[model samples]
Target chain A: MQKNTFKRKTLPSLAMAGPVSLWMILFVTLPMLYIIYISFMSRGVFGDVVYKFSLESYETLLDSTYFKVILKSIKAAFVTTVLCILIGYPFAYYIAKKPKEVASKLIMLIMIPFWTNSLMRLNSWLLLFQTSGPVNNFLLSTGFIDTPMSFVYTDGLVMVGMITNMLPFAVLPMYSSIEKLSRSLLEASADLGASGRTTFFNITLPLTFPGIFSSIILVFIPSLGIYTVTDMLGGGKVLYIGNIIKNQFGSIRNWPLGAALSVLLIVITGLLIYIYTRFAKIEDMEVL
Target chain B: MSISRKQKGKRRQELLGTIYSVAIYTILYIPVFVMMMFSFNNQRYNYYWNGFTTQWYAKLFNNSAVIGSLWYSVVIAVLATVISVTIGTIGALGLKKYEFRGKKFINNMLYIPIIVPEIVMAVALLIIFIKIGLSLGMGTILIGHCTFCIPYAVVTIKGRISGDGYSLEEASMDLGANRIKTFLNVTLPSIMPGVMSAAFLSFTLSIDDVVMSNMLAGAKNSTLPVLILSMNKTGVTPDVNALTTIMILFIVIAMILNNFIRNALKKRAKMEENI
Candidate 1:
């Protein structure tokens, strides 16, 4: 009986799950623990990580410069999330109301830009808004400004890049949720003599809260840690928490400080995800 | 009177919706369209439009560095897709089939990659690699890509496998087919769509990755995106624009082909049911 049970159940289960479990443990879990571990260690004078335990990295985070970047990153991420929602929610609603074939095609349209290299997309933005680029050229000829106004490498442009990069992530989840909403509920609301605006606010918006919540989680977290958009569009001038982390690991070579900042990011992510679980199931997260 | 007023309000709302969608889509696509147009411009600086020419495309083809990095990106993407798909599919199957201890923990573990920011994960992986004396190169890049991609594959495949119950597999087993045969004949076919989509997604992600690849890639092993990052810093040439246009066109064509094949398969399945 034991042999049969092992053969049919335990062995097959192990065969199936063992590889992935081992891979995750070794590659994913262990590395994550190592980051936490190294964050506590001291940085050597030569930019190497020393084995001595110290609280100096955490102390460095308390510096006003790092604190300001963290605040700025949070503000940037918040603004980006809000902008994505304001834009993506209505677009998702529009797509969800379309026929199934049309809705899928619309979704595909959104995804097409995403498939292109993100750096390429950011590059195009640079080309478009560069001092001598089309926008400035048009403005110069039309006499909008005497000389070309500098549009590249600004916080506003960085926000534009962030919105474009994150819009699809925000839209896809909301679209899925809004599509799942039943038409009968809307009709029932209308039949009960509710105004269209009322129906939307009370019925549609509340029902799609989970999607918006997930969208917030998706957009806010990544933008907080995203260096590429700010790096390219901000032109190395605007440093966020993400840029600081990159610098620490890159030019600064402060491994303990980088690891410490990453821990901060991880904590923020864990808190948001914890909040997300309170609102909805994690499995229902619409990543695509 | 009330009905006409209501109809007008509804019409106005729809018109607004249509206009909003059109404006949003234009915002999304304008940069891409502009990039494609400038790829053919005779101007090297891409400031003002000069006469159209294909010279940039020609130059891109001859650029060995761009071509080599692209090749490396493809190779890594393919390898990562294969590894993640195999591990993820099997793991999902195991979780679905067995009532095992620590199943919840394993499932939660899958969400870690999806939840955590890429920069943190990249730095984490880099630290561990340095600690273990593992040199950064294509090998480290592959590990990084697989680490993230596996969670996506697992989630996607699990959704498909769990949606359709195991009745067909059970029936096949009852008819004296062995477990391996049952899986091959029944379970695999049902999940093939999910598997294919997961593979495509994993490929796109690996190819498009910038943050992790930047950290994990050594000097000589930069992927296309990492290469593009460097190129941008040194002043982007028109050839990069040409390359971007080509990549966008290829992906669009591939997506359309995938959609076409899926529709045809669905039609054939419907006809089979009718017969």
Candidate 2:
């Protein structure tokens, strides 16, 4: 009887879980391990990865040129995250206060642009801000400037691109959190003679801290590793860690160095995730 | 007089909120709006509006490269969605229903694909492919997509299944139905909505992927986004704009339909519970 029950339960479970487990292990786990493994390996003269294990890539990362790029990427990512919160929080709060039907529609509106091809959106920014593009043309016609200012390839425009791409991700988590805030808590605080500012600071903000943190993780990490925005909007002029990693794999062909950079990103991700897990359950991450 | 003053203050706050929301929405949408509007603009470059025409839409069909890459993207999305949904649903059910060791480890592993940056995942996959001597192409792209997509599928399906207890399944089993039969009749139907949405999400993620697709795509076999990325370097014509606008419309309509169907199903389920 015990053997029969074991066969019935465990066999089916194994049959169900085995394929996916193997798939994840092979595709996700193996690749991740390979990245870490290769990072410690040395680079060859011809830009291929040499099998000999070395700390050369880690040493190369400490070089001032690469160090500056990492610092710049972090700065860019930090500014983007802060900006996303500042912009998204109000919008999320407003939506959360609305009736259910209206709130859903508002959320849908936020989502529509996200579903559109992102590269095309980046391209639109390029066209709209090109030296002879519409913004410049409009300004020139209004006699705002003598010449069209070059806007297509600048850090400012790249920042704009980054913010737009990451805004929806930032808003969704905060919206869900804000929406989940119980109204009675705020009402009770108000009844207790708390000022509106006091109620918000003491009650609402703390309640919504998980959402805010999730937004930071979602926005900051992607912005750090994003190269396409900088590549297009900055016109290859802006260099970030993401661009450096891409070039290492592409033009430079330094596989070990690229792997090391990726390891750094993974470490940053792991650290943020660790911090996030302390505040909120991993499952509570508002992925949608 | 004081009550009216408070009411006035509330009204002003509401108005400010409305204005802020509208401004943010406008900023969110302006670029895509510009892209959509330019698809109808009869111009070589999207700098100025010459005249409104749908010629770009017509030309888009004739652009073999666009159509071909689009075909590849659709194929990859479909395959990835189907594969991930099946494996994910099964995995979620097994993990949820049965006691198992290493469950926590598997659960943690699922988050890696979702939380890791796309560039990191792309390069990691690229490195592994090169190391394993697997040539980069559609197969590798499919593998990369499924790796990320399965976790999302599992999470989504897990949410649906975890909400309801196992009483119904137990009842079905006690009535002499085998486990497979119980799953077929009870478990699967309950999670249909989750499965459908997972498929939708996976499809969208697979199709819109540029980073992974670009890295995995070798000399041939470019997905639509990868093709578009390459075009950005050359010049993005109006046809690409037309294609993007069409995709935007298709996704919006699909989302509306999905929401409508989901609501209908929820109402039906609620009515059944009442009965």
True contacts kept of each: 0.71, 0.71
Number of clashing pairs, model 1?
A: 0
**Whole-model Cα lDDT per candidate?**
0.90, 0.90
Per-residue alpha-carbon lDDT of model 1 for B55-166, expressed as tens digits?
9988888899888999999999999999999998888898888878877877887888888999999999998998889999999999999999998998889888855568
Candidate 1 docking category? medium
Model 1, span A1-288: residue lDDT tens: 999999988999999988878888888789889999999998999999898899999999999988889999999999999999999999999999999999999888887878778887887888889888888999999997999889888998999999999999999999999999999999999999998899999999999999999999999999999999987788898888889999999989999999999999999999998998897998898876
Instruction: Tell me the TM-score of model 1.
Output: 0.97
Candidate 2 lDDT over B15-36, as tens digits, reads: 9999988899888899998899
Error of 2 at B72 (Å): 0.6
- Which lDDT value does model 2 have at B158? 89
How well does candidate 1 score on lDDT at residue A190?
A: 91
**True contact recovery of candidate 1:** 0.71
State TM-scores per candidate: 0.97, 0.96
Backbone clash numbers for all candidates listed? 0, 0
